[model samples]
Target: MSAPGRRIDVCNGDADGLCAVVQWRQIDPAPAELVTGLKRDIELLRRVHARPGDDILVCDLSMQRNLPELLRLLDEGARVRYFDHHAAGEVPRHPGLRAHLDFSPSTCSSLLVDRFLGGRRRAWALVGAYGDNLSDVADALARGDGIDAHRRAQLRRLGEAVNYNAYGEDERDVLIPPAELYRVMVRHQDPLHMLQREHVIGRIDALRTADLDQALSLGPWREHARARIWRLPDAAWSRRVGGSLANLLAGQCPALAHAVLRDTAAGPLVASVRAPLRAPRGTHELCRRFGGAGRAGAGGIDALAPGDLAAFVEALEAGDWG
Candidate 1:
């Protein structure tokens, strides 16, 4: 195989994943096809049909579950570059594929991309870190980079806004699909400009914060294990806010694992689980059991019907983790 004339970029739809590619494309200035989906759709590589010598770039998606597809792509002569902070499983020694993976609690795909690009677009990376709630890390990076507190706050708000836009059962529930949002983001090399020029970030924040206010007014889920279980009505707003709610609750009570659930017309409840910032392992295994997916500290589900609710509660209550 030779250097690629065709290029494809695949990523998770979260702010970090999309932003990483934004920075990369901004720096490199290339017209590549984008392959992405909802935040939960990490197996995007399988959907991409690339020929040998096609340049493929993967960002923010996990390698642990997509090794076969990735290896096949490499074997078929696609030049691949992977940037992620999730478990890579068995890393391969392949000349066609390159990887930059680091699973630090504070690291996100954007920062990983920032590192791989030597921080050429550090500002956008700051926004991605903030969106991922790598607060201290984002603050450190932003502050050290001569980004004032005002700008830092702006980035944090923008991060939350973009992240909020990603929560949904499907594209319809969200204000905009992740791919559409990515298009808007890619047009701007700097997130700050997007924050300043577009009302998108502010609108997202307003919607999310208002929802959190309502969820909080409902009362705590429990005092046990320093966790709060919030039950919400099934609606687009609930779907959008669940992730932000989990983050808001967990941040307010760092020792508490936050489980935000939305009742659905059918199927198990839709849930968002945030490990106690202090105890990231608490809800990881519990979610995995009910056909839900998540990291040890943070992750969520599309749905968990009524029958599964009891079991979901049991696992949460079990608190059976190191």
Candidate 2:
């Protein structure tokens, strides 16, 4: 008798990705090998090694970035399930692949998972939506589910903290590794219960607050009628705060697109871009032109050269995000 193949779960390490996987695992509760990494580590599927008959589950990672590896896995005879809300260039047809992809700016991987599970784990889904900066969407869902104002607020905070923790150049820049955080998060069926019982969430939230305060104190490097850009020095705090800072700035100025660029020790800059909240679109298109990729509402560049800064700003100023 041959042994059964392994169950491998691959996802991005951000709040949306983690929460999506949490919802699935909570319902299934089967043992699986988790392959995840920091926020910038979008190409996580390359790490997966699946054999024939293996069951592979993917969430939140961009299909465009992982398509080659995914095709290889499918050819190896693995059965794969994928869920995401990213700009997938073209989805290939495969008998072994079951894809649930939505590129809508308002939806995210967690919400897609929620729809699949029929909202059996709705609270975790809310955490993911909030973390992805879909506050209005999350709020409405929570309210419809009869979740009170206070609980909704708590869920938002938890989502933000978990999402914030996924930033940073690497694990050392973060307060906790995302995989370890996932171990902490998956223990509780209700996220509110985890918030009440675990001190880790509070610790992460406190650090996020401090870092954000420091970032907010800095003035914008460039400001325009339609956009604002902030540049942060190469520092641990800056590395950890860039993505969350961009999200906050976008919320504060719904009419203006926001970009946060932080200097890295390796010479190139890391950038996080958010489309105007009033009209969220075209971010992925912009980033793709610069050799980066993301969904329409949010995108990032892993290592933007200094020489391209002027051109990037020019494109930002000229973009019709709507």
Candidate 3:
């Protein structure tokens, strides 16, 4: 008799990705090889190697970015199940692939997984929604689940802390590598229990708070009637704080689009862009003009030329985000 093929899981290392995997694994309880990395590592599919008859699970990574690798895996006879909320340009028709993709501004990969599982792990889904900066949606879901206000706050913080930990340029800049954090996270069925039992959550939250505080002190680098932009030097703290800072700014000033640019060791800049919360649209289109892609509400550029800063600002100021 032949042995069963390997089970491989690939996902973004952010809260939504990790929580989606956690929910699936909790229900399945099967051993699988996990491939994940920092939030900036969007091309994680390139690192995966699947064999014929192997089972591959993907979450939260952009299908547009990983299309080639996904096609290769399918051609190699591996069955893949994908869950994501990113902008998928064109989904190929393949019998070996099962895709769950939703591009709604208010939903996330975790919530999709929760819906797939019939809400068996709704609390984890709430944490992921909050981490993805969908507080209003998460709150509504929590209310439906009968979660009290205090517990809702706890889930939000937990989600934010977990999401914050995934922002670094590399694993060294983060308090804990996301894979290690996932191991700790998977052991707890209840996110609230993890918050109470683990000191790591507190440690990560403290570091996030400190980094956000430092980033806030250096006010906006550029501001316009419709947008605000901030620039950060290439440092460990700045690398760790960029995405979280952008999210905070978006929440604080929902009337204007926000851009957070961090200097990279390379000559180019890395950017996080968020559309105005009041009218979340056009971010993906805006980023695509500069060779980046994401959902409508949020997008990022891995390497934006320094020379294009003015053009980027001008575009932001004139963007039809609604």
Candidate 4:
């Protein structure tokens, strides 16, 4: 009898992706090769070299971006399972592939896994949801579980810190690589327990605090009646704080759309765009026009030409966010 082929788990390095895989492994306790990268590294499906009959699990990546590679994997006779909440342009029908995908703005990959697992490890899912910036959804779920506000706050903090650590130009900008962080995360089933026992969570929180302090000193570069934009210099700290700053500004001024632009050395701008909390539509539409992709509430542009910044800001200011 031949040995079974290897099982490979590929996911995004952010908290939602990491937590989804964590829940699955904790439930099955199976051995699998983990494939992950920094938050900006979404083209992870191409990294796997699985043979026929191997098991491949993917989470939290856009199928639209990975369609060709995914087709290659399926054609190579590998059995694959995919879970995501991103914009998947087209889904192929194949007996070897099982996909659990939802693109709703209020849903995330972790929440999908939570539904699959019937909430067996709900706390972990909550952490993932929180990491994805689904605060109200995660909080409502936590409330149903009878968790107090204090513990809920801890979970939110832990989630934010975990998600925050995923940013950076490369692994060098982060305190620890995300795959290594996942190794530590899978050890604890409860997120709060991880916070209590692991020093890494505290370390992440401290670093996030320092990064935020630096970012808070900067004022908006462009402010209009309906939108605002902040520009950060080309630095590791700027890359690390761009997304978090967008979220912070969205929460602080829920009436105005916010854009956090990080000046990149590559002569383009990397941007994080958040629609107003009161009206979280049109952001995905906005980013897609700039060769970026995300959900309605939050989206990002990998690269925006310097000359196009004026037009992008104008679009935000004039958009009908409903």
Candidate 5:
């Protein structure tokens, strides 16, 4: 006995996650409530409260992070359908759980959803790959589908725009919320159509690029093999530019790990770090020093007090890659 009519969809508010749900709903069209937040809000299943006989769809979040909440939901009688490319520590066998989990470099939740939906939404799949920075993978797939290089570039740009929009400190820093963007996007069948017509994509790209320019204008940390840190003044612009800063630093100095540290509201500094893209390592471990966490390649700190800035800088300047 599966639940009917009581449906809830929850996913990370990034392009990959939302597009994953888009593919799913296209395959199984139904009206359901959506629970979503920012790109950093991947642990959203914890926020959902539902009774037994409810059908919940979750995507693009770590099952390991959501384990406790997932168990609670199942115990409360909610059946779950989960799709993800993140790590899932261990899963319990239960009749009520349906998981479509894949952890692969070329895959995102949207691509997985497209696969599950029998490739009915391949266009969005390209978008997800672009968002996830899987350019080689995205380019190859688009070519396989006989997409023109120009169209492949368009999808890549759309992917970058969509991915860029998901960044920022929180909801206030974004141009538009992911849920609202999803609403606008779901009206179209092909994302390539979006590439041609949607102004939101251009706005997002322009905003992100402008912010990146500002960050680059701030100059470099001028350090050696140690971590490179750029201190950002507290501003709405800084908040919006955080992700782009990390990316810029990563590309500008591929051999060194980078951190973009910005002042927050309460006098503490927030930081986003990226390991060497070509040799990504130790970022997660390094961020742990400031009470943040992420995977091997990227991570951040929630807050670092004023006194800690110098120490943090010293640590960054002395970052040991050896």
Candidate 6:
């Protein structure tokens, strides 16, 4: 028989995206073309050159941003299964497309895939959830699913390490490309096994510790009663640490919203905004004002003009988070 058409798996490079695809492939093993990029590379769908009879699986990336490409893929006679938690505008009604999407602030794409798989890989799902900074939700799921505290912490650390590996201005800053990481990931049914047997996890954990330590040494560039902002220079370290630092600061001061602004080489700022953990709202609202979009709890602006940093801070400061 002629070789079957290609099966491509495209996803965001973060832990949530990786774990989601990991779960799916674990349940249904197949050889597929893997397309993914760093955390900031959300428009990944455009990279796919799918032909008729090809199969595509997209995870953790935004449907809103990839709508046009999605429509085009359907027109080309490909079968696409999309799983995501990001903002999805109107979903097209196409028989070839199978969409599993949730825009709720509490959900992540991995958890959605876990739901689809009937919790066969709950451990991996928790890892993805923790990586997305849904600590509380992941913890609750762990508890409900009978995962011991020790195992839960291990999963959390693995999640954080996997997530850390996905950051950086580009692939060079990351220790391993996510596609390669996924190949290593799929070989094991349990993530902890990967942690115990593989050197990759150790390398990632060490990098995360180093990046976080550097981030901790810096103080807030601007501070207000309800919000805080940290300005980081355009460097590999800053790009690697930006989102993780925002999560750290939010955890340290649950009542204060946090924004980590990394100066880009193009003279603009890429901002990661996290609403107060105590009140996880208004972040998406704030980012939307500046031409960015994300969930309510965590959102970002891809490029904030130099003149608008002050205005962005003002909006975060003045917002009614209650």
The predicted structure with the larger lDDT, 3 or 4, is 3
lDDT of 3 by residue, 120-190 (tens): 99999999999999999999999998999999999999999999999987899999999999999999999
Which 10 residues in a row give candidate 5 its minimum summed lDDT? Answer: 220-229
Write the residue-wise lDDT of candidate 1 on 1-322 in tens digits.
5554688999988888888989999988788999988776778999987787899999988787689999889887789999987756689999998888886666888998898888899988988888887787889887788989888888888888888887777888777788888888888877889888887677777878887777778876555664678888887777778878888877888876678888888856788888777766645457667766656677676668788787777677666445
Candidate 6, residue 17: lDDT: 94
Model 2: how far is 1 from its true place, Å? 2.1
Residue 22's lDDT within candidate 4 is: 91
Q: Please identify model 6 stretches exceeding 4 Å from their true place.
A: 1-3
lDDT of candidate 6 over 26-64, digit per residue (tens): 998988888998998999989988788899999998888
What does each candidate score in C-alpha RMSD?
Answer: 2.5, 0.8, 0.8, 1.1, 3.1, 1.4
**Candidate 3 wrong stretches, greater than 4 Å:** none
Runs with alpha carbons beyond 4 Å of true place in candidate 1: 1-4, 303-308, 318-322
All candidates: TM-score:
0.90, 0.99, 0.98, 0.97, 0.85, 0.96
- Where does candidate 4 stray beyond 4 Å? none
Model 6, residue 179: C-alpha shift (Å): 1.1
Clashing pairs in 1: 221-229, 267-305, 268-304, 268-305, 269-304
**Deviation from native of the Cα of residue 34 in model 6, angstroms:** 0.7
> What would the TM-score be for candidate 5 when compared with the true structure?
0.85
| Model 2, residue 104: C-alpha shift (Å) | 0.4
In model 4, the Cα lDDT at residue 276 comes to 88
In Å, residue 17's CA in model 4 sits off its true spot by: 0.8
Cα lDDT, model 4, residue 107: 82
lDDT of 5 by residue, 176-200 (tens): 9988988877777898887678888
Ranking 3 against 5 by lDDT, winner: 3
